[model samples]
Target: MYGCEWDDETGATNGFFQDGYDGEDFLSLDLKEMRWISPVQQGFLTVQKWNKDTANTEYQKQYLSTVCIEWLQKYLQYGKSSLQKTVPPHVSLLQKSSSSPVTCHATGFYPNEVKISWMRNDEDHDEDVDLGELLPNEDGTFQKMSTIRVTPDELKKNQFSCVVEHQGKTIKKTLTDDSLPIGIIVGALAAVVLLVVISVVVFKVYQKKKGFKPVSASDDGSNSSAHSDAKA
Candidate 1:
């Protein structure tokens, strides 16, 4: 139910309008595609509901349902436009620490119209990347692969990204390193800190027991009196 042309110059879809507005307990096409809706799935729909007495904004269930139906009717009538005009953009992140190669492939394109490049921290990759051939599809679409041989030092910046340009727009998706698993690292650090705290508590108890010696004052006084009598 998307890609509904607005006017002559702006043939873009009205999907953005639906995106801006929201409804409650109502029917919807897809989030992006905005496909068609069925009558069977129409009943029990609730959009923005209002009070009959006060005529104020009471519940939004009935209101959203009405909006969805109106948008769907217009969407079906003007949704005949083709999605083939713009090439679908895609980027993959394949991480490899081996000496072989790190390759990423992207498909769903309108051949020769989309351009892709490999970059390491926004710099042009010269000797590292090996560009692959573009394969064509039955619908005149194309797919391409780009590979880069990254060194251990190059991966230190932790900012490798793939840049794709098509239809006067640029999009990028960053690559993540396999060596760094955030959850595991945090768990290991927590375990180490717990062990250190337990060890410190155990050491304090051990020292208190070893250094303690109990004595009575009456025994010392009697021994001193007997020693004074012997001296007299």
Candidate 2:
């Protein structure tokens, strides 16, 4: 496999095999550090040989360094304008239980620099906010989260929200009060719906069983004739 450089100042990694570009299946290497970081570990014979050869070619460092720098420059210059975009966050509020902190998650954003806040009654409440770090998504986007603690009494007031600032847009998501009761209500409603459906099905089956069944045409005529004879 192939890898790329990690820029410490910018806190990003680049050039990860380009997703269908040139890459070997089992020969991983760090081209910038000149190290076999994977597949050719320390105890391998191939590692020993490669290390020896690399040490012998110390004079080639200048050329390799130049190539790495130029490659980075070319990619940074050509790709940034077209490939980079700022994606807005999708905000949500979650809680493990009634007593847990309200975790406000802001996921699916790009550029990795976003500000998340937990507010009370439209005012910033920093004392209760626990800001989390930016995390990378599988699609090369970023996600972040923040949380705030709340008591049951405080939750009853229902004046809490999570706000996100990204790409010059502000998005706020409000947290609901008494989530446990709401969940119970929803579950009870579902159960009631299920019961009603079951009752309707059972009633239909019972009615089908109790429904009148007409006799054959000849039998009905014979019964009517017998009744007429008895009445006469």
Candidates' lDDT values, in order? 0.57, 0.70
- lDDT (Cα, tens digit) per residue for candidate 1, span 126-170: 567778888886776777877777765566655667777777877
Candidate 1 is scored at a TM of 0.38
For residue 113, model 2's alpha carbon misses the true position, in angstroms, by 0.2
Angstrom error of the Cα, residue 128, model 2: value is: 3.1
lDDT leader: 2
Can you give the TM-score per candidate against the true fold?
0.38, 0.47
Per-residue lDDT of 1-232 in model 2, one digit per residue for the tens?
2334646489555443211213533343444666543352433565456556875334344434455556876787798874567788888787766777878888889888899987888877887778888899998888888878898788778588888999889998888774553445567799999999999799788878999344443667887787667669
Error of 1 at 102 (Å): 1.7
